[model samples]
Target: MTAITGTVYDSSGQPVEGVNIQWSSNEDPPVSSHERGSRTIDDGSYRLVLHRGSWDVHGTKDGTGTEVETVVLGADDAVVDLHFP
Candidate 1:
């Protein structure tokens, strides 16, 4: 398993609170790949745990903006920090 984390901010560079994050990985195949995610805390920080592999990560905020990243996870837990400007 791998551990990914990061902080969220707005265009003004202020910490955003109560942001929504979508985290998912290849579940079956092209036929079906479940999309799972979580929301950030009041401090604008969040974390997700997934299996070691290549997965796509996306962070979204309502009425704000969204950030997407293609991550290649390794056997050891990895930390994916994101800075949305």
Candidate 2:
């Protein structure tokens, strides 16, 4: 397993708290891969643990935002900051 950490931000360069973060593996054939999610804290920081693999990560806030990224996690931890505009 691997751990991913990052902070969410808005277009105004301010930290966005309580945003929902969703991630799903992009494996071939789309088998029953593990999908995980988490929400940012008051400080706009979040951490999630998932199996080592490639994933498509997305962050949504207030139904009018978009922040997306692709990440590959290895045995070690990873960091991915999401910024919504």
Candidate 3:
């Protein structure tokens, strides 16, 4: 598994709390049930352990809009930040 970490931020560059973070595998013949989710902590920081593969990660809040990023994980971990406008 690969460890993914990052912080969620608003348009003004402030950390956002309680943002929902979800991800799903994007590999060919996609793995079944290869999806997971988490929420940001008080510091707008979040972490997820995902299998090595291509995946689409999404972040969203009640009214702050949603952000999506595509990540490819191999042997090394990755950091992906999300921004909402």
Candidate 4:
């Protein structure tokens, strides 16, 4: 498993809390969504442990809109930050 961590920010560059972070794998056998997501805490930080593969990470909030980022994880961990505009 690869560890992915990052923070979410709004258009004004402020940390956003309670943001839902989700990811979809690009592998041949897709991963289940049940274990592929996280929610940002008070500090806007979130982490996900995912199988090594290509993934599209998405961050969403009720009124803040959504942001997406693509990441390729191998043996090393990754850091992907999401910022909404």
Per lDDT, the best of the predicted structures is: 4
TM-score of candidate 3 versus the correct structure, residues matched by position: 0.88
TM-score of each predicted structure versus truth: 0.72, 0.87, 0.88, 0.88
Query: Which regions in candidate 1 have their CA more than 4 angstroms from the true location?
Result: 26-36, 83-85
Whole-structure CA lDDT of model 3: 0.84
Backbone collision count in every prediction?
A: 2, 0, 0, 0
Candidate 3: deviation at residue 24, Å?
Answer: 1.4
Model 3 error, position 16 (Å) = 0.5
Sorted by TM-score (best first), the order is: 4, 3, 2, 1
Cα deviation in Å at residue 70, candidate 2?
A: 0.3
List the pairs of residues colliding in candidate 2: none
**Following a full C-alpha superposition, what root-mean-square deviation does model 2 have from the true structure?**
2.1
Worst 10 residues of 3 by lDDT: 28-37
Winner on TM-score (1 vs 3) = 3
The residue-by-residue lDDT of candidate 3 on 1-85, one tens digit each, is 9999999998899999998888877888875333236899999999998889888887878855557788999999999998996
In Å, residue 1's CA in model 4 sits off its true spot by 0.2
Per-residue lDDT of candidate 1, residues 3-67 (tens digit): 77777777767667767766555435522233446677887887877776776666666555557
